[model samples]
Target: MRGHDRFNTSLPDDLIIEIFRRLDSKSKRDACSLVCHRWLRLHRLTRSSLKIGASGSPDRFLQILSTRFPNVTDIYVDERFAISPPPCIQGRKRSRDNSKVSSEESCGSVGNVDSPYLSDAGLAVIGNGFPKLEKLNLIWCSNVTSDGLASLARKCTYLKSLDLQGCYVRDQGLAAVGQCCKQLEDLNLRFCEGLTDTGLIELAVGVGKSLKSLGVAACAKITDSSMEAVGSHCGSLENLSLDSEFIHNQGILAVAGGCPHLKVIKLQCINVNDDALKAVGANCLSLMSLALYGFQRFTDKGFFAIGKGSKNLKNLTLSDCYFLSDKGLEAIATGCKELTHLEINGCHNIGTPGLQSVGKSCRHLTELALLYCQRIGDPGLLQIGQGCKYLRTLHLVDCSSIGDEGMCGIASGCKNLKKLHIRRCYEIGNKGIIAVGKHCKLLTDLNIRYCDRVGDEALIAIAEGCSLHYLNVSGCHQIGDAGVIAIARGCPQLCYLDVSVLQNLGDMVMTELAEHCPLLKEIVLSHCRQITDVGLTHLVKSCTMLESCHMVYCSGITSAGVATMVSSCPNIKKVLIEKWKVSQRTKRRAGSVISYFCVEL
Candidate 1:
């Protein structure tokens, strides 16, 4: 030990720092901190990012964080810090009724020492502490008002990205951001209800030139005027996500006309129609990704315009656009030949014609999602399978019309398919899945939840042909021990597995897993009543690398089995079981090794 210490001491500080810089894992760095005071100090100095959650003493926590990671450029404070009040303020009486308190008073009361949550006082500490902070994510910090934001903006002048999602930042906060934080580029003000057109205009006028990405969701008061101001000012904006009730064509038109370099746009609006989309297609020639949700008024004409203009569009998502039929989708497919990803959900009118158009025109398409598009059947999938041979991912949910034929087509055509998720598609059966098992040699992730027709035959086929990393056949009642055993024997690289609600699964399956699966990290055996303590012990003893074990409602499992699992698996982080199954002794044992031992009621 002395010789080793002497040898380590001979290594220069710069070499040690370089070694620490190479460590990408937080756990490895934490272990280094325990080596000695010198190592701890070096680790702290090298740390450049910090994420903090609820602490008993927030002031002390902030002090330690600032002292340890003085060079941290990014800080993320989770919602727990805002929701969980410190003990000192928990028992204090409110000066006024909670409901009657003004937003400003509730959030910006810096003088109020009794503030339960992290108020402006906490923000002041942050502003003064981290001088190098370039990114700050105060997500869902509702108690943080305009005053806190102003303070942060003034102090963190080099801040490039700010996420004030669910904060009480009003016009004052926007004004401060505009006046200060000249280097700010990315801003997310989602769910900031206090923001109006006035505040948005001010922000656009101030930081529009440098801002690259902006998200303003659920800001009800923002209208066309604010968007017009943004369009006129924010010429450099590349990504924009807007979800507002009052925004219409005029606002969109202004944005399209101004931000010529815009690459991505996500809009969820009630008033936006074909005209706005036409304007976007015509003006934003650089657009690569577009997502429209719940836009009831958009029709084929708008899609035609988009296809005609935005030839470079690679990704498109249309959700709940009930008015858009096969014609609109066909138009898009014909124009956007470079599209790599397309997702259509709740567009009931879209059927085989639209999908066929996509398969024929968008040969480069790699990912496709059809959710609740009941009109689409095997013909549509067959078309896709025949045309889009490079397709890698396919998601089908509640597409009742799609059956074995479609699945077979997909399996045969997309030989390179890596991920396939099918849920509530009862029509698909063993024939379809077996084909996938045989054809998709590179299949890594498979989820067929609630696909009742899938049985042991499908699993056996998959186990024989494919080396899957993730497999979730939960609620597939037809799958039994044979299927699981085959999987355990075949998939040596399997990291995640969920066989929840399989009544037939028993100790035999566990025995197979123990002998075959050494890389299994997470397994969900929820409601598998036949799983007993004997099998679980064997499994836990063998699968030492298991990180998460969920055995909710496994009636055959007892305290002794739980104790063995918690004690044996040093890397185990989470365990889920029934409330009654966790004895006092087991709880104590689990409390040390497990980070989250949830007791399901």
Candidate 2:
């Protein structure tokens, strides 16, 4: 109906637009679009967002997206990927069974850290389809090569945020991305293995100046030269993660010199020496959060530099920096008055004196991790409890020297403790754990991994008092079947549990778990030989929602048993049975079990 002829539309233009925008799912929009010819012509030409999903209808979905949504601004995909196989010997031959395994699975053929194939190539295709695309996320798509990523950068002109996590793209891809996506703000290459010195140089030349946030974590190929390039080029960089063994004094110096406006920096597993640390302390004056885990060469000079420069530091970590002593910690305690989260895990030189300094000065400290700090005893723990009243999360894993007194003090003082990890602290007997569990009612996650003293009683107390959603009592050899069963009954909201080495678990615990937590999707019973066909039978029958079950080394499983469970659980995606085969009858029960396996252990 024409406007002059009194067009008989009931809704106003704005209302119509709002209604059109409310359609989120692509299938719904497509259904609406296909209803009539007039509806398609009347709707807005440009799509508000682009979601090219590979979940339901990959072919039709991409087709509609490419053809209809040409001006789409946002692009999101399920980047479930895998990597290629490494070079094998010339004469090596894989058997017919191995070929079956390879043919069934399209990605992650050799168990590369990230899913194998989906990232770069997938992004390239998506990019080619949507030239005006703004955001791209390629998580765990290791199969993506630099060529595919480069194609994306070259094609997608208006790209802003790009996440290439666990992808195989190197410097060439980064260089291309930097050059083409000039408007890029956030670039994440976390765990991208192929990036090296020359590639980093190319990257610096391309997008370093325009970048606000960049993550180069676990990029082992990067050295001091590339780091210097990053620091010099990306002076406005706010967040930087340099987790590499090669990044030493020179690389850190470059960062300090270039990115003075930085607020967050992570040097996890770095090899920075004293001079480099001093450079960081002196230059990055506006530092707020810093992580320096495993920088073994850290010394008093670095501390002094930090003490003088980052006087307003809020969060600091000196995890595994063994050379850092009480004097250095005292400097930090004295200097950074606003510090709230302090982690000195495995810093052996920081004894009671260091703890005293932290306790006396950092009143606002909420999260403290002193894991494996063997020198820190009850004296330090007492001091922490007495002074740091606001402490919420304490990680004392492997700090066996600090016994019941420390735990008792913590129980009394830190009433707000939510997450506690006393893993491997054999000295933290049942009484100490119980005392903490009794007091800390707000506990949502607890990890007593390798804590032999922790028994069924401790778990019972945890279940009774705390609302734990995540629990890991892995390697706690002392905890028997009764204790695990109590945990199943107690923690109703438990979503993630890792009781990998608990040998006592059997059919009863499985029954309780299945009955209590119907949402049980992932169960890792590795090394628990006691779990037999009966327990699996109960689990398969009850928890139909189970997605991934890891029953490796549970020799009790026979071919027939696995076959029965697999056939019954239609929703079961992946089941790990490293060394057993199912019977013909069980195989008969399976409709398409061949598609759900990655056989090589």
Best by TM-score: 1
* Local lDDT at 224 for model 1: 92
Candidate 1 local lDDT, 183-256, one digit each (tens) = 88999989989988888899889898899999988888989999999899999999999998888889999999
What lDDT score is found at residue 394 in candidate 1? 98
In Å, residue 67's CA in model 1 sits off its true spot by 1.7
User: Per-residue lDDT tens digits of candidate 2, residues 1-601?
Assistant: 3444232256555654456668887677667666455456435343657543234223223443466657677765544622223222112344677543332232212222223234443555577778878887767655568888888788887888888777777777788887787788788778888887887678776777677787777787878898788888888888887777767778878888998988888876456678877887888899898888777677888888888899779898877787889999999898887889988877888888888898888888899988788888887887888888888999887786888888888887888888888777878878888888798889887888888778888888777788777788888888877877777787777766777888877778888887786666667777787878888888778777777666667777667668767877767776666533645565566634433334665
- TM-score to true structure, per model: 0.91, 0.74
In candidate 2 the C-alpha lDDT for residue 204 amounts to: 73
Give the Cα RMSD of candidate 1.
Answer: 5.2
The true-versus-predicted C-alpha distance at residue 116 of model 2, in Å, is 9.1
Please tell me which predicted candidate would have the highest lDDT against the true structure: 1
